[model samples]
Target: MTIRDTVIRTLAHTNWRLALPALVLTCGSLIVQAASEDPEVVVPTASPTTAAINPAGVVTPAPGTAADAASGVVKAPIAAVAPPTAPQAPAPVDEPLMKLPVNARHMLVIDDTGRVLMAKDADTVVPIASLTKLMTAMVVLDAGQDMNEEIRIEDADVDRLKHSRSRVRVGATMTREAALELALISSENRAASALARHFPGGLAAYEAAVAAKIRALGLTHTSLADPTGLSPANTSTAAEVARIAAAAARYPAIARISSDKSSAVEINGRPRELRNTNHLVGAKGWDIRLSKTGYTEEAGRCLAMRMKSGGQTITVILLDADGSAQRLRDAAAIRKSLAKIAAA
Candidate 1:
């Protein structure tokens, strides 16, 4: 049976409630489908010449006709039928695209030479969350501020909670160096704000300097809307963030703080052991020089790092990963791809 008839019959077999609407919609859909399938219609070409008529209205034979002493009566030009079009290769099935977990948005792994090894939506700008502390650390170090100077955490520093995790207590006093360490190792938001406040011209100047530093690093795709990665507005691409991590790794202090799995810091006049959020620091087969872990509702469990793999130095950035485990899997996939390439 014709497709149209088949659809009509199928609709008739359904219950009235569904049948009526189904039939109407199916009819329109079938019409469109059939129209698309119809072959192109070619118009017939004209004959080279036609018979002439005398004044007496008598028909004169054309040059190619038998009466003209050439051939039989002129044949009507045939419409040139296109050889039935070769059946189109069935359109590709359009296999479903891979879907990442909710926590991860963009991820990348790169060689030390800045070659991208593997990436997923790496260029899409999303919040870096607490990863912003890397830039804060860089800016603080760049300012050449006295790390040894003691800085007191004022009530103002503790006032803006922003609901982020912190190791800095409101009344604690600590060395600038220790505070910086706590910020990087523990993702301490309060310490970061205190450092920004202590910048050469205070927080305002610090914010400006962060932008300037991003420009200096040629990170066109990254921006610092806040000292801490607390603001969802603080966004950066995986590539740009990898570069930031690479630069951050050069500082002995940053390396020292980031690689330490745990360190003791005095909080509220009591010693509290703060651990590195990046589990890969001491994990087997990972030579992590510097690393940080970040997560926010807007920015899923994110990580950025510099490490040695297969005797080659590399950097990795994973943003909005599904879970902590998936980030590790993504990193492993990158290493495997690189290994295969190297073997080739």
Candidate 2:
């Protein structure tokens, strides 16, 4: 018989409606089973760069997705989602750009525009020793006295307060210019006292002039008890000392005299050579524009310098170091740091 005739004959012996419902259920289950076993079928998953919104109403864009890019959001490329790199190390505590090893108890470094480059305890007041000669020289120069006039180094010029010995003797006489050279170059106490004593109105007038200059320079933290700086009372902060150095640099005579590595002058009618207290003044690779060195029991070793490096003007002040060697090392360290900073 034909297939249609045979199927009709079998259905005639059963309930066709109940059999139709069973057939529909069996077909649905077979289709689901077939789909689960299919090898080529792929189920969609969530994107790795899915957008997320926090409770604070901030929406983080889904990166590396075309939907985000279509909405004007910055989309990172697929190749840009690289594995995180290791963190870099922090700079050392003594980074040259910010800090350096320094031995002085107080220091201040600045540029020509008075912008501070480095500082440590620079605002604290301390005895300045013979750094006072810079002010003394300024006062003497401001008065416009005869630099060629001979000034006798009397007994009053002797260091009674400190009992400090001097190469310029009590009976010795030298020109005011020579005395200034000795005072600044060699830090001669007798020479400084004689310059002040020979002031137009004497030492008292010289003190007044210093006070005026301090006011003029706006150096509130500086005080001068004596022109020679032999008195422990002669004191200033490193910041104020820097201001004094800048003012001294403006005077042609002070700048010229203080920077001299050595000067030949006749003392007691005998010619003698005076060497600069600052050894760096004539040292190789040191472009020192102005330099001064000072020391005392209370002040320790002190140095102030205006230097040029890499076409920049740098002023360095060191105070209360343990010794001259330590002071010079600190200065050298600072110079090296400046060179690095300039190079970078």
Candidate 3:
């Protein structure tokens, strides 16, 4: 082809590339506008199957799926909405290249390379306290249950394990989305119980689901008895806690909400402020992506955090700490020591 012809073709190709995104954006805007209009148009949302959920909260199969042909999922009277389960990353390989001592009885720090940078009694099984909520969030999100489903706090969720008090009082109402947020962000025992209670087969089924998930994730040394870590039975090793933290950070919902400095939700028709259990989330220069704090007489003050700062990602697990302040100090010391090792 002649140079002039080739140049013209190149320009046309460039124009197509430039215009395609603009065209898509314009069409997307129009569709959004249509959806946003008063008496909003009913747009059938697509899922893994050809099924669609109606605005009136009914599940109907789209035109030609097998479900439509059989009218199976449609006439069931109840819809099964499962969360898309994201596969877990394989367990990290142990690299005992460096050892750093900390106050905690069990501690672990894993880097993005899946290397155990530092560890102390990481395999000792101990009660994880609220860190169990990390697994709870994972199990719930893996179920892909309707996030908008309303969950009412009941006396059943009154933390029979530890009798912990929650800012979200019983008899208050909120969505599963908010419940999950409250569970992970604030480590609310009631929210955790409510999530398990509202699971397909109730708390028992939720426990089974969590167990199945643990098996699936290959957590041989980690198993939880309840949704909340209040029970001493909710136990795991520091190594496994690191793995759980890694898995939690992978989910956008868990990663996003767990790291939030603060969240606001309507409880009993009044705005309630929920603070993150991990105070490191709000500290300057500490790019924590996921955090959970737990404390019980058995679990002591425990902390699990996934930090992404200065382009480095590391998971910190501290269990059975003496006090909350001491746990924070250990974390800071660990980070400092890790930084020095990395610099060397």
Per-residue lDDT tens digits of candidate 1, residues 278-305? 8778887677788888887788789988
TM-score of each: 0.67, 0.72, 0.70
Q: Give the per-residue lDDT of model 3 (tens digit) for 31-77.
A: 67656874855433222122222232112222333332122111212
Provide the lDDT at 169 for model 1. 63
The lDDT of each candidate is 0.70, 0.78, 0.74
Candidate 2: stretches off by over 4 Å: 1-94
Q: Model 2 — which ten-residue stretch has the worst lDDT?
A: 50-59
Best by TM-score: 2
| Candidate 2 per-residue lDDT over residues 172-266, each given as its tens digit | 88888889889889899999999999999987888899899888777777889999888889999877788788778888888887788888888
Ranking by lDDT: 2, 3, 1
Give the CA lDDT, 0 to 100, for residue 115 in model 2.
50
Off by over 4 Å in 1: 1-103, 159-161, 267-270, 336-344
lDDT of 3: 0.74
What is candidate 3's CA lDDT for residue 60? Answer: 26
In model 2, pairs of residues that clash are: none
